[model samples]
Target: MRAEVHAYVADAARLNRQPVLVLDPLTALDCSEAGYAEWFTEVTEGIEAHRALVVLKDKECEAESPRTTMMTVGVRNLRAAAPGAMVFLDATQLARKQDPPGVARTLATWSVKETAGVAINVGEHTPQAVADRYGIELRQTLAVTTGRRDLYVVADSSRGGVASADGCNPSDARIGSYEVLSDNPETTQHLWLTTPGISDGPCGSAPASKPGQFVPELATGLLAGTP
Candidate 1:
């Protein structure tokens, strides 16, 4: 289903004249666990094109936990690519040691400071818990398709979320402010996006050699628009 959907979307995007978002699988993998400064810098610099879609593989560890190359690296890269580009974070990519609730809060905090749109795909066991941590509600948005049940959620500081800290929480630092798309920043704005298969499948990055290839349902959910 994931592969089928991506192939269809990629093909559709091509025919419809949509911007092609690309990602470097190897780079994402390299930055997965610990911060690989060199790799992160190199990869972020490579995807500098405006409006380019960036995708990252959500690697799952042996124990079925999500693995993040480096939370900051991914967010940082998104900021660099397009300050307004939505950052679709696959919770499964986070390591086991990293608590989902904590990570979610950290992400919410980053959203407040960077002004970037962030939508996290959560699993059953941790969904509500994360929602509470960041004070975000999983509300339903207009149905994109009958086959999928898509919902929307907002991530802002009014919900007790804060931006990633420097000096103190260096690993989760934000480089600069991200431009706000919609919703008021003064309060928790119910931002828009879809979350169909939030806990749908095993998370992992696409093959390093072909990052552009379809990655199925793992973290395929779009930020604000299709393809």
Candidate 2:
């Protein structure tokens, strides 16, 4: 599994794309402290070599605060091994037992300044419900071009007005989707914007147009700096 992960990262880096690596420490739990340290060192070195982002899913078990300790160790190791890479904590498990807002705040506070951000899976939960829990507002609607199959536009709401148009016109060949955008533009962030029941899966359905079909022409009219 680890070797597969390394290959995935290397492939993404070779193509000049960023890859996100998700890790669950079930195996690490059984290893001795020294063994765990060595494992983490090797993992961090691999991540540094590939310049990938990591998401650690902190799960609780019988041991007293094992997740908390593992998170601490993981963050410390990453900072030492790969200071340039980003780390995200997926605290969906913890959020199940506690208030989402409180959990989000606590994780943000506990995280190091360099720690990228935190995420909650909210599986089987409505996006609105989760947003309300975090006190996040839906400030804008983005009508991203369905024309570009490979491109997904991610904008920070706090940065304000990612694109010129607020809503899509009837003639537009784009889909209107919403998300909780970040305030900080410098953060490494990605968002998926899809209508309800519209699966963004690769083999789902064919889009009406080809890649760059509408964006180039639309950008000339909408984007400020485009000629």
Candidate 2 per-residue lDDT, tens place, 1-227, comes to 45776787889988998776666665563534454566677677676656876766566645544555667677778778877566766655555566644564445444523465554432212233333333221111101111112211132121122322222211222322234345553322333322222222222122343321333333222233423
User: Can you write out model 1's per-residue Cα lDDT over 48-144, one digit (the tens) per residue?
Assistant: 3323333333443333223443444556656875453444443323323455345445444333233233333222222223433442322221112
lDDT by candidate, in order shown: 0.34, 0.45
Error of 2 at 68 (Å): 1.4
Q: What is the lDDT of residue 36 in candidate 2?
A: 53
What lDDT does candidate 1 reach at residue 34? Answer: 45
Q: What stretches of model 1 exceed 4 Å from their correct place?
A: 1-35, 55-69, 81-84, 92-103, 106-115, 120-227
Q: How many backbone clashes does candidate 2 have?
A: 0
